[model samples]
Target: LLCQILHCLLILLQLVEIVLFIVDSGCSKHMTGNLKLLINFVEKFMGTVKFRNDQIAPILRYGDLVQGAVMIKRVYYVEGLNHNLFSIGQFCDADLEVAFRKSTCFIRDLKGNDLLTGSHGTDLYSITLQDTNCPNLICLMAKATSSQAWLWHRRLSHLNFDTINLLSKNDIVTLHAYFATEGIHHQTSIARTPKQNSVVERH
Candidate 1:
């Protein structure tokens, strides 16, 4: 009778442990699912507003959904300082012609400072006309020109005018020249090999 009672008690304890483990695991899984759902819901809600301001307005004004799509794509897709500096007005006759005729033009930093001495390069006249949007442009310009060579190199290295698609051949040429002038050249230290030199030479 005593042996049978002890065996029953051991079996009961094992079952209780197994049940508790299962319950804890299930609870954790449930909590994780709930957290993920909440995060997704919040992201969707915020995206709704961004979509209207950045997407819908441009579509209504332009009348061409494709152009609107391109604009939205550029606004979202392009990374770094130069992306925000470009806009629809850039297609206008005055801005477009100036961008083409002057190689040195549009070399100004966001703060309206000339990137090169006036004798060497030109500043974008339209940039001054964009004072209303200055606050945003200022932020981007500051970031790009912050560490002169690095940002300048990055801009030149990945020069994709496809999004705005208005930069002329001259614009590209001038930018390339400016980068060559301002970029830092890193020199590699030469290591001497044993085969090329006397191994037992004394100084």
Candidate 2:
């Protein structure tokens, strides 16, 4: 009876749900309290994490978050954690690029396909896992595989991707040059991405 009770308590400690996932540069690894969000969960002791308040939470299990095409590999389920965290470092470790801008955050594969996008809220960036009727943060960007790349090219009048990229880059520079010519001082978003427009339109 005592062992069963302890097992029940362990289960309770390992779960919480519908969490807001924060894109955190400060968090060293992916973490969540909700075991329900994880697929292929493996109980593994990976030491403990100390919070800002100095409370230590034991790392209870290892799991991967599989949301649509976006799979955050090998996340740790920390006991009693209140929020889900995606680590910039962890993304980089998997050869993914993490970008933060004035109002946008993006995770892209090396081929420049966006895996996920999030909005900047105050200093924290939060992402949505599904495209439901939930406030903001919906719509996962699908990867344009090489097989489908030609379709995109044909759709754009056979305009190659490199040329499209150049056009976008040059368009931004041209706008900035115009701003400078008019003596209108301007600040630029990192990488000068025009991503905020898509995010706005989606929301």
> lDDT of all predictions, in order shown?
0.24, 0.70
Deviation in angstroms for 61 in model 2?
0.9
What is the Cα root-mean-square deviation between model 1 and the actual structure? 28.7
As a TM-score, model 2 comes out at 0.55
lDDT of 2 by residue, 105-176 (tens): 889999999998889887789986742223342222223455765554455465354654564574522444
TM-score of each: 0.14, 0.55
Q: Give the range where candidate 1 is weakest over 10 consecutive residues by summed lDDT.
A: 12-21
How far in Å is the alpha carbon of 108 misplaced in model 2? 0.1
Q: Mind giving the per-residue lDDT tens digits that candidate 1 earns over 1-203?
A: 32232222211011111000001111111111111111112121111112313642111111111111121111111111121122324233122221223432333334554322211123332221111211221112222323454555464455364621343342423433533465622223636423336432222
| Residue pairs in candidate 2 whose N, alpha carbon or C atoms collide under 3 angstroms | none
Regions of candidate 2 where Cα sits further than 4 Å from its true position? 1-19, 131-203
Error of 1 at 73 (Å): 22
Prediction RMSDs, each to the true structure? 28.7, 22.0
- Which clashing pairs does model 1 show? 104-122
Q: Candidate 1: where are CA atoms >4 Å away? A: 1-139, 144-173, 183-203
